[model samples]
Target: MSLNDIDNVVEAFVKGARVASKSGFDGVQLHAAHGYLIAQFISPKSNERTDGYSSRPENALRLLKRIVSAIRSVVSKDFVVGIKINCADYTDDHDRHALVLDHFRTIAAWGEVDFIEVSGGDYEKPDFLATQTRSPRQALFSHFSRTAMDAIESLKQESTLSAPLPLILLTGGLRTPELLHTALAARHAHLLGIGRTSILCPDLPRLLKEMEKETREVGTASSEAYWSSPFRPEPDLTFSPIIRNLVPTIPLVGAGIGTAWYVVTFRRLAAPPTSKGMSFEPDYNLGPLGAVFWMWIWVDTRPTSGMKVCRRRLSPIGIVTAAFHARWPKSPLCKTLMEYERQILGLKLEAGSLGLKETLAGREVYTHVGWLALVSGAGISASTTYIGIVRSGLPALIHERVTSTPADWNAFLTMVRDININDIREGAAELRAASQRERLMEERIQAMEVQCGIRAAPRDLYY
Candidate 1:
């Protein structure tokens, strides 16, 4: 962001906080996680400015600091103010987990903040937030959160107490009672947060509290017992592990795919099961085929033909090729993806073909928050941007993947368009384009400034 816009951005935070504070909300958590504007300023890969905002580590935090101060000034001291931050950038060479912790330490120590929630990864590499696998590694970000909590704890002990020391909230794969209880018992997190599991089982909070009560009574119920309570959601049951493990061809990654899955889950949980034979839970209803198509639409990357576009800093080989020299289709990696989808999902696809209008027509309006819903295949073809490539782009890109046979491909694309699959694509396309347009205008301004000998480069007074 431009320096001139700093005050305006800070004003937005303060104003929003005041509104929330007056609206009877308990507190407001500054969303500094998952590649938001605050996350961008904190991330080294995105923040390249040479001004005071980016000159040093503390300077990089100037925007957040100003906003925090402004929010505190407007709201009463008792009104809680918190911040959620990513532990890592997850991009190559931009590994700044330690730096983020130190920055977090400084903020928590200043005592302006009430609580700190630690999350990691953004759309560029969102696996930190949502892993590709059903049973992903647990507490991937605990080390960072633990370190921050320890630092803040020391600061509280070293200094005189004003308010209680800030509590740490850790989110990421803390689904099971065992994981949640273990983390809290070990002081890895003062509060435990669950994500997809909560969507799968909305009563997770009550169940957990009840389970805690039960455990206190029995005193010997193991992790196995906690899951076997029957009220506990089998969150991992959502995906066909064999199929989900494939494609994106990488191990334990793919944020776009994960978001898409959660979106589908959120939609299912939002409504009752269909009266028809079709189950709201796609995984249970469609089986392996459903999972394959899930990956196919959300995470799968295809080979590019002819000329290449320079979207990223590295070679324009695309994500798949950048990892493997050959095309994803020909490569042995994720070989099971298409095979399973064609065999299994093909049946579901054919069923839709018969009653496409009746089945999917009303559901287009299902997702209230479009991106999180993965509505119209959002994040399906993301490259330059973290969010999916929008509804139209999904079909456009999928058209390339299914084009091995011209007749089959043309027929499929026709069916896709007929079903209004790209309903949300227009909005996604506009949002994705706005950033690129801004970048283009900035580049053009820089070139003109150089020609005019105004300076070696244009300054970030573009607020």
Candidate 2:
């Protein structure tokens, strides 16, 4: 960034800290980790600038130092200011790694900072996501955290400040309570951080408290006692091994896809309760394909509300059909479209009707029309006329071919046994034939109208 840009950037951080304090936050942590903008400037692998920010290692930290000072000027002493820096970027070079650690020690020496949260890796080597399972024999990031603590301790002894040393927070691979307790006890890190595990078990702290009570009653104290207590963390899902093997592993596809899965889950958890009901449950069953689909398509992510028929946008032909139907409701085209819509809706209601009926047999079936926007307003006739085409006629055709014996999710192959390529081909052929016949009839009618003087002939024909 230019000199002017740097000034604006620092000012923005100061403003953010000010707002955070005023808004009743405990502290603001500057994210100079995980290949972000500030982290980019700190990493020699990425930063190629000849500016003051990149001239030397100390100068590389100049941006963060400026922000810390600016924040201190605005917020109270009680308002904690922490910086999350990389333990080291993914590099094999010892000198480069040492330089990165030195940058961390330098920040710790600065008295204004309250805490330093150490996290490693970036988009290139995203061990930061911690989605992959590491070998139980070797702990993740334990060595790095220990070395970082030693560096901090060395800085504290050299400094003349009488205040306590800044706390070190180690994040990544702190899944089990056993590992967390061990990390703290060993002084590997003063604090610990959790990520994906928290999403899987939101009430983990409460669960742990309950386990501690049970274990105490059993006269057991070891962390392993809780392992048999019926409260184990759910295995976090990711791409299948087949997919992993298919892609080049160096730029790990699982890391990116796994992150997307977590992101989609976050959105689901944050969404407010709809008119039908709230779907607070995390979709753990969501596969890699569904993850990409939901991430890109907004409408698909929207939870299927009540058992009502949902409609989608009408195609160009569908709009014309609707208009023609509205003008002549008794016409063959109008009648045929109406019949198609009714048949499709019947199929939908039948397919999803069983499970709900068995559970809520007597209760009224509440229909939800989520796609009302497309099927309403001044063009209501045009929209409603093509209701059969909701998300394509493929769904209706598939439903027709499949058995009406209610869905058996366990026997997924059985449920889709009848929906073969032949059925799909037949459906497409029928649709094409119908569209061609309709177009020809429409042209013939227009010509007949002009000859009978029911409609004026084109003046250009005589010219």
Candidate 3:
């Protein structure tokens, strides 16, 4: 769905909650946690708008208020409304802690929200902040680091000043019974939101209670192995047949086809027309089928296509080729061409591999079907620039496989290594050439001046 469509759905959901409350539902908790839409809007880095939705700190709050207000219009005043916010997104700038706290302050004043659940991080950077998948690998003491404990303490302190909402649910890294009890004793959190642990051990609360009676300490409840034992491997759930059947085929089809077209169109718009005044109009010539084919080809053979149109000069044939190529390379396009090569070659390129460096340096030759063109035309010079700014900036686009899978991480490291080496090589060559030219000119000027002095030392100063 388009962004506007998502916005409409969110607004409708808020309105629906109010309607449900009016119909006798108890309350509604706006699900803003785990780096969902609301969380994206709340993040300073994510919401870069300078307009109504982007300006003042209050602008950020506006979307949340609209949702709440829509709910309030339909629901009774007695209904309980609350927000679950991330205290610190692991991926967000560390400096954004202030903004996060400020956002919470705004929510607290709303009077509609009855509670706030302070979690941390988005899905992409989910270590302990949003998910518990990595908890087993962590050192026992690693969970209670000063930063983690301090952030929790700060959230607790902030909630105290929050209007009337007396409840704060802290979720993230709070696995051990000892940690939970300590937090409870210190009044850091009211509800212990056990996400991964609960998933692993469904009856953890009961088990903890039973263990509490048997022992005075908290750690006696369960070992890491015990918690990990009950963990069921999560299965990949495909879209339901109903959804597959009901959703319009156009969007899926459009995305499949139009991605490259959109990129080429956007790139053409970004820059001045070439010397010939030739312009790109993907829809006009390519049509939907052509656009889809180009989009697919661009995705498949991103390495070859991504670099070709870096300057955004699209000939009629280029457009046709883009359409043809997109469809030609059919598997779900990896963001990078190196990824495609790795997949096809079935060779793991580890960090610092010379071959990996060669492949990445050669990436400029592999033109990004659509997005990369748009990115490069819009001023992304290199793949790293695209990754750092565009990919990292958008939570949805930031591929999390790098952290979730060791192989992905290794691939990323290799790519980065190659990019860095290429940059250094180019820079060093330029600097050396420039230095040699400067030295040669200096020697020539010195020789000429010496010859002039030898020819004429008898010039009259006053004359």
lDDT per residue (tens digit) for residues 392-463 in model 1:
234343444433333454664564554443644753575567556655454444333322323321121110
Backbone-clash count (model 1): 2
Ranking by lDDT: 2, 1, 3
Candidate closest to the true structure, highest lDDT? 2
User: Sorted on TM-score, highest at the top, how do the candidates line up?
Assistant: 2, 1, 3
Model 3: how far residue 305 lies from native, Å? 56
Residue by residue across 265-380, what tens digits does model 3's lDDT show?
A: 44344334445756332234445444434433432223454333332323435554555445555634223545444332222111101112212333432222223443355443
lDDT of 1 at 77: 76
Q: What is candidate 2's CA lDDT for residue 404?
A: 36
Q: Estimate each model's TM-score.
A: 0.52, 0.58, 0.39
Report the C-alpha displacement of residue 134, candidate 3, in angstroms.
Answer: 8.5
The residue-level lDDT of candidate 1 at 225 comes to 79
Per-candidate clashes, comma-separated: 2, 0, 20
lDDT of 3: 0.49
What is candidate 3's CA lDDT for residue 32? 71
Candidate-wise lDDT, in order: 0.58, 0.63, 0.49
